[model samples]
Target: MFEYTIIDKSLENKIILITGAGAGIGKEAAITYAKLGATVILLGKTVSKLEAVYDEIIALGLAEPAIIPLDLKGATKQNYIDMSATIASQFGRLDGALLNASILGELTPFTQIHEQIFNDVMKVNVNAQYLLAQALIPTLQLAPNASLIFTSSGVGNQGRAYWGAYSISKFATEGMMQVIADEYENSTLRTNAINPGATNTGMRTSAYPAEDKDKLATATDIMPLYVYLMSDDSIAVNGKTIKAQ
Candidate 1:
């Protein structure tokens, strides 16, 4: 499992938001961040799952978490704008945000790809992210220092056979991160992407069923990088593609 030898309360009092916070990498990141002293706003399609994570954080005596049940596949610009406004009202400012929610549509040959699947994947993986970022920029700017982390994939940087729309969306994600990073180059906000290579998550299991799950790193393992990117420790690092393994 991935481990972080260093632990600090540097994130104390930080207001952080994590999409896809109900499961896998997103869940682990939310738990870790809360433990390290950030008040996490958990966003996921499943209210039950989000509540579960919230309860776990409360159980640990960490910062209390808020739950937002939202499905990115069907979210609109107005939805993101409303969410941003809500966060601003509740937290005053957003210290960081993790764009971790994504959909992996059917993996098939380019000629065999279905339009519905492609559009669905793009809506969740690309469009929603863009809208969320656009909506949250004002909230992020209110903070003294803020970070935005986008979840990316290896296939994004290098095209692979049969990776389908998921890969394409990740590429757009990386590009989006770079564009935002560049735009906020002299500002308090920073953006970056992380490729959590071959972790033992449901998504990895679906992508590589033949692989030995026991050999893969757990979602917790890659959290150090996640925490680092979100916290002040990595304020100087931006617009870079980092691998968490």
Candidate 2:
């Protein structure tokens, strides 16, 4: 048996923020959440892509989602702060946030990794989450309950050759979830990580170029867990990494 697909309207009126929402898993999750009645804030680097997702959500007659064009790699602390302020001013609180944006640096030997690539990966994947968390905690607290979801990877827990900086960043992503969860234990925030195993996203294609793409699940297939975690149904689940396969 499996979980994550039992849908309910419990997410009605919830305010959620999903990073990297332009495409891939993040985009799919945003649409799914909107259908379930949550007001979603789409954050991504590409305005056009974000607009497309926004149009889709609106076309479906779901909640009108908001868009924030943000490049995680270059986003500053003030950007995070301004985002939090905007969310607070607009919605008064934030019920959930999925840190779903990440970049996989070159899949090469660790010794062969270029410095810029490494920095870029770490900055987008790890540092951005830290800054966002710091900025959003107050807004999250304004909610009755809040879920902080991190997009983790299997390679984060186990180091594999050629995974390089991407792997390292994932490991740190999980650790950040644990640390944040521990610190927020008695608070309204619950931090958790989800590892979307072997999904059919562009990132997966780059990682396993020769693999049979048809056999892999699409981004929509892994969205059940995203919905469950963001809904009140999983408020008790905290400080753990879950696989979305």
Candidate 3:
């Protein structure tokens, strides 16, 4: 199963929304889904970056993508609701959502944790996810089968001393996934979390500047697990925290 290949049309006719779709794993997932024949809705804070991903999908003669410029840190519940309403109007149903947007607060000691940084991290990593999931539930229910994925971290499962707010936020993320998964266990909607471990991304660099980049897997290399989660192949997989590579 690990060696299985994701085919070109694996996601044909699917409609997927990806938060933080401007770069890193989110960007790659958006592109990969588009290539697999899914209509992708790219959401991020940067218009230029989202446009670049949009153009790339268009240029490939793949599904035309849509862009929603949003900063998760500042987004309100109403904003997510409005976005969901718009998606419902445009596509009728949402097939998948990859909640990949997260904020890594300063890695500091427990006693020295800054208040502002802690609030900011929780707002983006936890609050935003809660609002987004709440807003999109209806649209997701409209689909025949919907997949909701949360971006999790290793520190979330087993707390690390210096990981601080980022780790706490991810633990909350894992909790959110399990709660939603249990609630919708009998429905078509499935919720799960993925820990993209040791990926060569900006987040990793920020978290471990002294670490060797060559030792980590690239964002593109982790797409198989992501693709599997989003595709119908993993319909029975829900509420579990899966690691990428």
Candidate 4:
């Protein structure tokens, strides 16, 4: 596990947006952020799942979380721009954004990769992230300090056999993070990427169905690094990919 002290209410009065907030790591992060006193904006494709998370946060007496039911695969650049505009209009500024939403395209031989699957994966994991980051950078700049976190994978830095478009998309994600970080290096907005190594999520299960999930770390177990990167403590850390295991 990444070693970082979890502080109480470290994110107080912050406005944070999290993609894939409907389930898995994204859902856990949303609730955790709310517990730390952040007004979390939950963005996901499933309205019911987002609502369930919202209800759970409200029941815990945490900060009230807003939900944006959006499918990245179908959403356009203007959609992302409008979403950011709405968030800005309501919250005044965004303190953090976790771009965690992604699709794991079928794992197959490099030569056997399907065209449609590759396109779909790139659409969600690459293009959508590009659009979202472009739209959110302005809002993030509004804060005294802001964190922009992109989700990456082990295969992103080191290629693995049969990972296909999923791996390629993550490579693009890392590249995007670096480009954005470099551009905003001297600004209040700091950009970084997190490689949540081998967490037991639905996407992991789909990619490795026969693996022993009991032996794998849960999403909650890896949140220390997530919280650390989003907090003011990490204001000096930028343009790097850190592992959470």
Per-residue CA lDDT of model 1 for 17-103, tens digit only, reads 999999999999999889888999999999999999999999999988999999998888999999999999998999999999998
lDDT of each: 0.91, 0.92, 0.94, 0.96
List, residue by residue over 12-66, the lDDT tens digit for candidate 2.
9999999999999999988888888899999999999999999999999898899
| Clashing pairs in model 1, backbone N/Cα/C closer than 3 A | 2-221
The global Cα lDDT (0 to 1) of model 4 is: 0.96
Highest lDDT against the true fold, candidate: 4
Predicted candidate 3 versus true structure: per-residue lDDT over 1-245, tens digit per residue: 13448987999999999999999999999999999989999999999999999999999999789999999998899999999999999999999999999988899999899999999999999999999999999999999999999999999899999899999999999999999999999999999999998898898899899999998898889899889999999899989999886
What is the TM-score of candidate 1? Answer: 0.97
In candidate 2, where is summed lDDT lowest over 10 consecutive residues?
A: 1-10
**CA shift of 218, model 1, Å:** 0.5
What is the descending lDDT order? 4, 3, 2, 1
Q: Write the per-residue lDDT of candidate 4 for residues 1-245, one digit (tens) a residue.
A: 99999999999999999999999999999999999999999999999999999999999998889999999999999999999999999999999999999999999999999999999999999999999999999999999999999999999999999998999999999999999999999999999999999999999999989999999999999999999999999999999999998
Model 1 residue 131 CA deviation in Å = 0.3
Clash pairs, model 2 backbone: none
Winner on TM-score between 1 and 2 is: 2
CA lDDT, candidate 2, residue 150: 95
> Which one wins on TM-score?
4
